[model samples]
Target: MRGNRVNPNKPSLYLPCETRNREFEAKLLLACHAAERGWRGVVGAKKAIDQRIARLPRGLYISKSITRRNRFILDIGKRLGHIVTAWDEEGLVFASPEIYRTTKVGATTLTIPEKLFAWGEANATAWRNHPAFNGTPISITGNPRADLLRPELRDYFADEARSLRRHHGDFILINTNFSLVNHFLPGKSLYRQMLQAKKQPISQYGSINGLALHKVKLFQHFIEMAQAVAQRFPWHKLIIRPHPSENLDTWRGIMAGHSNVAIIYSGNVAAWLLATRALIHNGCTTGVESFLLERPAIAYQPVVSEDYDSQLPNTLSLRVSDLNTLYMHIDNLLQGNTSGQETLLKKCHAHACQHIASFDGKSACERILDSLEPTKSLLLDRKKPPLVDQIIGWTAAESRRLFKRTQLVRRTTTDSTGYQQHIFPAVSQSQVETYLQRFSTLLNRFHDLQVDDLGDCIFALSKQ
Candidate 1:
């Protein structure tokens, strides 16, 4: 925690990303935006942040979530005199506000972040209504993730999207978000893990179990849908992209004999959505992204529950409850007959406007940077942690690191790094530089931003 005096010349922003495919590009865009404003943006894998927090320069740390585990990390950052702020990655799409509050946010975690960024007015209102809210400023600046779907930044994925189209021509992308029931690590259940972490009460067992059952039903339905699509349209490719946390082997095993189907879990989903003919999902975040991208999105819901289904994505999509209707919608969408799509998208746009910001105005990256302006001077003048506190914080971080390593070693379910790679495969310095260059070309900005490799899949973006 102990560090040298503040540089003052250029403030730093530490943006840690947990899942690479989901968060990396958006955070990188934010980092590039920060650098353009004369701030050094340190962006990297979340593990890198945890390992280097004690030694890194104190700055404003923008966390991806405020779960209890994240609260511990934020505690360390706070001890090190780093300003803390966060917006839950899972906050935008959920079954209900109450369930989200119970399962995703903690009262103690809420106390750690100095400020909270909300995806939209809905999330801001939800957080404000939470009993644990301590009057912290909540900015309804939207999420940078949403910024990627905006037309202005869609070219960021042009190369990847082109490659996808070249390789998997006219594919129907099926995105599944069922990690709660089917996790990458064997025997791992996100539901049980949440309960074990005290994120939910024992009283929530029934509700949580019901949600898990609902997802299982949806998962099975997706498999059936995939099979049906493969058989129905043998000429077209049926690509199944499971949630990053889901077991890939299970999918491969299930679709073993299907020659037309492929299970892929790589790259940012934006590219896939761009390349696909149509996106079929139940209630995934990507459905909303597809709609925003003006792509055809179909929500195949064989079973639905008011209490368990996510509202926004489903409502935003063209939903069909049966396989025949799903096939018909797919056929119509693929053949470019968007007969009912425009009206649906118009209504969905109005609906999405209530839940998402940054659809028509300045990008969320700019909005977030604007919100952070008032904190820059404070961050520049921030003092270092006292030696005693530094020692304690360092010791605690080391102990926790060792405990996690020991647990990883003891696990019999998967390889130590398998799940990590599945979520965020190692990123290279060249990849960061390439994307930064792409951003510069696409937006005619960020030309002065320089990248420095900080090891452990981390990089620093700053003005050269």
Candidate 2:
């Protein structure tokens, strides 16, 4: 979608898509809102973030993947005189060692972003004090994605949630976070590596490789827990929502012959959270989301340790250490007996409010836009890209697309019965407008800005 009457000379707001489309939808919705405020906005494909920045007028560009590996994008944005901000999409709960690894943190510290917007105080504090981001500016702006599930926007997904309930019926959501077994390398090889890495004696625990091995073992335990739940609750409907990075075929195989379980992967968690009887996970951000949505969240950690059990979700969610405890809690929730968890819910609310940023739903996005407002007049006007440069960009994009297609074809040929990939669906113009209209107050408050549909994911630009 595009903006109407956006002056070519005016500064623009550029948001790049992520590998997962829902992640990018957060930025797309923000772009729409920005357009309504008389700010020029552009949503670029993930692969063409650099190309879009190079061709467009200098403005603010927000990207989720501004790691040291892709620091070249930071350099390009700098050379072009654009303000680039890197926000963490994964949040703080699952802090990857890569963030602190010398390869990633050391190289991009100075060039990445002038400021990094974190999920909350906890995340902001962690990133600020990290050896990698020692001197970087970090703000505790609640993630915009979480805003989609806030109370103010609860009605936004009401229809979708109702539809999901009608189709899937009342069910408990089992959100999985075992990407190592279900997403990354071949499951057999990955499992072998995990076993090998875990063979180190207890003294080696917490080491770089040990940390990963611990994670892999956790994934294995998570799957076993799921199996136990399925067996114990044969009458109840269980909806297993695998991580977007997961392979669904593995889940399908695990759930085979279990008519009581269904596997789903796409769509926002808010709808699913709203529809479910309870949200069950080990160490996932969905529990935080479920807490915000006023849903019962149970963190099942059958195999726990200090290094792994200390996640924010584990702290906020009701702790269920064994299959029996999980079943008891889930059964109580299904039977409408939540009086016992009052203290736990209160703690979750307090922690959420303190660390998850804005619960009102509007502040996070507004704060982001407010930060970029000052840059409107500071943009440097440059001549459009030469035809040769444009040609090269287009050629490069096409080549990457072809290469990905070839890889997909090869994978399908090699293992036709393997796990099928589910792509995140795109948000249509109608969907964007529907959600944008929910912010009527913001739209009316900024009547000078207007948005229009520009096909091909590029929009026209103008101010007033």
Candidate 3:
């Protein structure tokens, strides 16, 4: 059966975003690029996409990740006659290729996506060498997320950074990425949940447990570092931005009694990195972003584990192994003494070049759209699924929607909708338009793009 019909003459591109602050603006920029190329770009929350996938018009679906957990969505999209492609958002800054492939890339799910996009040479090499890889043709186009960090696009976040600096003056931004152990959901640690879902076998439990233990140690060190910073610099604010999936209450509880410390998990992190005097993180993706933005990135590694620590981000940062050294580095950075930053960045630049393509000339978004252009006709000409299969898919989607509603109602305090909203708040068409306007002002492009509300926090962008 035919799915919901759009403008058949205009091919559609579906982009599902799991995290708003991280993926929304980047995907929106990508959508604008797609619209410029005369294709309809539908960008939405992942939940919305999952609920409406079967009903939406057949299109090229770009999945955020290809983990085993995403198999259902991949299968459904293929069964509904949509061309599938994917790039892992968490693949670039990983512990090791072996561990990353084991935990993030699903052996079976890797075969589903017809094409794959890589962040850089390292990512492409890892995926190409995977046992499940079947000559799927991996494109080494850097992520659109990295596109936002390019100098040309830095102006897009200028206003937000200014406002942040005004509200929180000269703050030390501490970005934590420990949701695997400190998840907002009560019994739902990401590692544990993956195990429960059989994403990895029982034999892998020891490795998972060890990684969790390492993260827990790092989590505790971060808390201590925050406390120390608060004590050391009572005049300046210490902002602790937890991971979206982390428990904000836990951070608040530990950081209580510190008047200078604020537990904030709002807005895009690029703004925070721009506004802060220096960014403090261990192995977060934000560390690399800060380096890209020419900000002082401090990797506080009080408790280090070579096996568990992500190399790229930390390597790109100014590593400090103790609280005293962290304080000294912060002091120097605050005093505008960047004597060693240039030297460190120079060394890290050669390493980062292997892992990330910063789009010195053409943007990553443009490159990705260009890559998709050659396959557009083939994707558009594919036949629709059989009527019976479409019916089955629709029924399954409806059942999932009903089950989700029920689960939402049954969730307790820690596992409630509050956590989901924290990660992906309700988005409006106005917000999308505002971002589009910002993009237009920055690049003098996307002026012809128009936003259409597609409901369920989804928006479609196309040329007016």
Who wins the lDDT comparison? 3
* Model 3 Cα lDDT, one tens digit per residue, 71-127: 877877887778889999997888878778888988889999999998889999889
Tens digits of per-residue lDDT, candidate 2, 1-464, equal 23545576656777776543356556755775576666677764554455455556667777675456457666556555667787767654663433233213434543468777877787676565555554766667777787676666677678888998898776888988766555633543343466666555344223445455666777778778777877887777889988766677788997797888888876777888888887888778887777777777898877776643437777778887877888899889889776645676665566777677776545677777676666565554444445665555456545544554455445433122122234333445566555455554433443344555554344432335
- How well does each candidate superpose onto the true structure, as a TM-score? 0.93, 0.82, 0.93
lDDT of 1 by residue, 18-117 (tens): 8999999899999999988878888898876777887887788998988776778888788778888999898889998877877788879998898999
Scored by lDDT, model 2 comes in at 0.64
lDDT of each: 0.83, 0.64, 0.84
Candidate no. 2 TM-score: 0.82
Q: Which stretches of candidate 3 lie over 4 Å from their true place?
A: 1-8, 190-201, 386-392, 412-416
Root-mean-square deviation per candidate: 3.8, 4.8, 3.7
Please report how far candidate 1 places residue 232 from its true position, in Å: 1.1
Q: Among all windows of ten consecutive residues in candidate 3, which has the lowest summed lDDT?
A: 1-10
Return the clash pairs for model 1, or none.
none
